[model samples]
Target: MTRFYWRKYRSLGVVTTLAILYLIVRAKNYEHKAFVFLANVHPSEPWEFVADFSNMKYLNPTIIDFNLLDESGDYVHWKYSLEYSEKLSHWPHSYNTAVAHFNIKASPKKDSYFIHSTHKTCLLFGLYCLNSVSEFKFSHGNSSKGASCEEHIQYQCPTVLSSFCRREVVYQRKAIMNNLFKKFDGRKF
Candidate 1:
């Protein structure tokens, strides 16, 4: 009788584990909002910076390459690779590299310009449960010389995991912005 019960429980355990794995691998529903950072630059400067694919390699230290695939009017398609760097080598997902496709839109009106970017990884099970969209709104600054740019990065994932990882995601976004600001050489509009 004990042997019989043991086998039943073992089968149940295996099924349960498989179900959890499936949820983790296929969940894909999360939204995270980070603290917005405003940059001192011209509204056009920020939108133009991201529109040019080559600028990513300079703005972001971890990004080694960004290839432009297509551009039609305000829409742009590009693929980028994040390489292993000393700063990311120790993180859980850092060892796993990602090549992702970005769909970007550049919208400029009378007073402001917005850059919207949505991305998905090339691999099916890319990073398990986390996906994100980043938007930057640049408006003419009150000062005649400089413009103000606001960044909002949102991360989406399964509910359980989103709660656990929200803070980390926010911190990561802030770090990215800080890095960009440090690398960017102020360009005159």
Candidate 2:
């Protein structure tokens, strides 16, 4: 009689262990969001990565910033910001921000909205997510290697453009950087 009870208890313990493990794994899997890359380009060419705007890894906590400039070169005109954790079914469904301007002198009167978000990290990170979302509205369009990316890249204009105008300048800069950080292999963008 004791042996029988021992066998039954052992079996129950095994089953409970398995159940707990299954639940742990399931919960872990649920925390990860999978997404494919937006571009399949040669690593040597950054432009290739931006060719297809639709190809992006969805991400979480999308970064949004909108700023409007007035004629006096002042940021006093307007601003709006939106953040999203998911791209589809628009989790937190209704989010909209608006800024109004009453100034007349803003030359090229500019209002820009920028987003940096993702559902995943690494290649499926913020860069790919932003490009994908930007192109979502214009999928029925051209097939350029970096048209969409280039357009977005334009927005990321350097705080200094003249410094990047020449190839020799860039080469020299990178060579110097390599020499400076040659010991750091784990340093990634």
Say what the RMSD of model 1 is. 5.4
Worst 10 residues of 1 by lDDT: 81-90
Candidate 1 deviant stretches above 4 angstroms: 19-40, 74-108, 122-130, 141-145, 157-172, 179-189
C-alpha RMSD for every candidate: 5.4, 19.5
lDDT scores of the candidates, listed in order: 0.52, 0.26
Model 2 clash tally, residue pairs: 8
Clashes of each: 4, 8
Model 1 earns a TM-score of 0.62
Give per-residue CA lDDT, model 2, range 121-186, as digits (tens): 112243221111111111101332211111111111122322322232234224322322232221
lDDT by residue for model 1 (1-189), tens: 999999999999999999988776554555544332334556566566755657665545445444455445533333333322212322445422343344444443446666566654322334342455777666666555555656676655555555545655555555555655554444322
